[model samples]
Target: MKILVCISKTPDTTAKIAFADNNTKFAADGVQWIINPYDEWYALVRAIELKEADPSTVIHLVTVGGADCDPIIRKALALGGDEAIRVNADSHDSFYIALQIADIAKKGSYDLVFTGKETIDYNGSSVGGMVAELLEMPYVSLATKFTLIGSEAEIVREIEGGEETDKVALPLVVSCQKGMAEQRIPNMKGIMGARSKPLNVVEPVAADTLTSIASFDLPPAKASVKLVSPDTPEELVRLLHEEAKVI
Candidate 1:
């Protein structure tokens, strides 16, 4: 089986985020980048687990970004991705990014496509579904568990109140979440092997981007915590009803 995993580079969670170019561009200086955790810990790791279960399976990783994103792709390779593909493009627009990935998936004839439920940076959670739609294939989002038997797949995902189980044939796209798999750390052997893995850079297909970022501003600073005495239950109720508006 050929499984394609979509990976993305995102600013490390602890990195200080900033904006530039009149708040229209992200500030990259001094920011550490890493594979989006959803991609690494769930989507990619689950694909690796599948490969480990079946030696004939091949896992290919793909990303949409410029040359600077190579390290992130390499990291995916180090985590057991057989090969990598880089779609040379700016992935700010979800539709455009989905187009690139969908085109690759079509040409590659991948049996299964996997991606994180959402990227940490933008948290759009749109690309995987768009890719599935563009390819006219089935897609499941926020899948917590996945199992493959022959050409059929068994998937479990979270829904409104609880988990929903599903079954789909091959040529499926899934956006994975936390319960899908455990995180894998790259060992010395895997790291060394990744250095020599094939990393193909491809041009993106033509696609019209429908949206653009206008500006970015930090959230308002958090207010100090207010304490209410246990005896003054009415005060707490009043605050929740009036100030917080959460009652």
Candidate 2:
């Protein structure tokens, strides 16, 4: 089986987020970047597990970014990807990124494609679906469990108030979340081996960005807590009804 896993670089969770250009752009200076947790912990890890089960399975990692994303791709390779592909472009538009991935998937003729539910920075859960549409393949979102039998796949995905099971054929796409697989840390051997793995950079195909960020605004600061005496039940009720607006 040939599996293509889409990975993305995101700011570390602990990194302080700030905007630039009068709050119209992200300030990336001094921020440490890592593989988006959903991509690393769920999507990529699940692909690795499949490869482990069948040594003949080939796992390829692809990311849409510029040269700066090399380190993040190397880290993913260390986790067991056979090879890597980097799209030589950068865009915040989800469609543009998805187009690049779809192009690669087409050229590679992968049997299965995996992507995280969303990227941490943008939380735009649109790429996987768009890629599937572009490739004309079945798409399963929020997949928690995926099992393969011969050429068919049994998938369990999260849905409204419950989960749903799907049986799809090969050459489908899945957006993975928690319960897909546990996280794996790269060991010394894997890290050393990754240094020798091939990372191919390819120029993006013709694609137009459909959206642009107008600006960014931070959420309002938290309001100070107001205390109410236990004895004053009326005051508490009044506060809840009028101030906190819970009632």
Candidate 3:
């Protein structure tokens, strides 16, 4: 089986987000970048696990970014991706990004496409479904557990009120969140192997873009906390209703 795992570069969760140049761009100064947590922990790791269980299987990392993302892609490759394809493009909206990924998948014809439920930077859970739609394949979102039974895939997903499980055939897409697999760190051997492994970069195919970023801004800092006597339930309620309007 050939699994294509879509990895994204995300700002560290604790990085201070800010805008620059008249609110037209995200401030990168002093910010740290990391692999999107869900992508690393769930989608990518699970794909690695699948390959581990089946030596004949191959896991490939795919990213839609430029040279700036090469280091991160190399890190993912070191984490166990057999090879990688860097689709050279600046992704903005979900549709535009999905089109690029789908274009690559068309040529690769991967048995399975795995990606995180959402990118931590934008938190848009739209890419997987869009890619599936572009490829005319079945897609499962927020899958917590996955197992392959013969040629069929059994996926357990979390829904609003409960869990839903389903089975699907190959040539499918799955967007993973929590509970899929534990995160793995790349070892020195893997790192050395990654340097020798191929990191192919391909120009993006022409695709329609549905949207663009207008501006960037940060939410205001939270207000100071209010302290109330522990036993003063009535005062707390009154304060919440009158001052904070939290009730």
Candidate 4:
């Protein structure tokens, strides 16, 4: 089985986000970036579990970004990906990013592709579905469990008010989320091995940008909390009906 995992670079959760360049660009000055933690800890690691079960399985990681994303890609290589491919392009839009990833997956002849449910930064969970649509394959999203059964995948996921399972054929895309597997830390051996692994950088194919960010601004702050005396239940009810208006 050949598993292609899509990885993304994201700002560390603790980073203070801000915009510059007339509010049209992200301020990267003094900001720290990391592999999208959910992708690393859940999706990629779960795919590695499948690799461990089958020695012939080969896991490849791909990312859409510039040279600045290389170090983190190398770190993903250390985590377990046998090879890595970087689409040399600015991931300016979800559509374009999906196109780049889909093209690479097609060229690689990947049997299965995995990506985090969404990137922490953009929170756009569209890649897997887009790839599946482009490739004419099935896509299972928010997959919590994955097991191979004779060229088929037994996928389990949660649904509203209940859980559901599906058996999808091979050559499918899965957008993974939490509870898929335990996180795996990159050890010394894997780190050393990553240096020797193949890291391929390729120019993006001709693709049109379908969307662009106009500007970014912080969300409005929450309203100040108002305290109500607990001893006066009638007053609290009155407040809920009047000032709070939540009744």
| Count of backbone clashes, every candidate in sequence | 0, 0, 0, 0
Which runs of model 3 end up more than 4 angstroms from their true locations?
231-234, 241-247
lDDT of 1 at 43: 95
> Candidate 3 lDDT, tens digit per residue, 131-161?
9999999999999999998889999999999
**Per-model TM values vs. the true structure:** 0.94, 0.95, 0.95, 0.94
Which of the predicted structures, 2 or 4, would earn the higher TM-score when compared with the native? 2
RMSD of each: 1.7, 1.8, 1.4, 1.7
TM-score of model 3 relative to the true fold? 0.95
Model 2, 56-102: lDDT tens per residue? 99999999999999999999999999999999999999999999999
Clashing pairs in 3: none
- How many steric overlaps does candidate 2 have? 0
Clash pairs detected, candidate 1: none
Residue pairs with clashing backbones, model 4 = none
Give per-residue CA lDDT, model 4, range 1-247, as digits (tens): 8999999999998999999999999898988999997788877898899888998999999999999999999999999999999999996688898899999999989999999999988888888899889889999998888889989999998799866999988999999888899877899999999999999999999888887889999899988887777787798888889987999
lDDT of 4 at 166: 97
lDDT of 1 by residue, 124-155 (tens): 99999999999999999999999998899999
Strongest candidate by lDDT: 2
lDDT of 1: 0.95
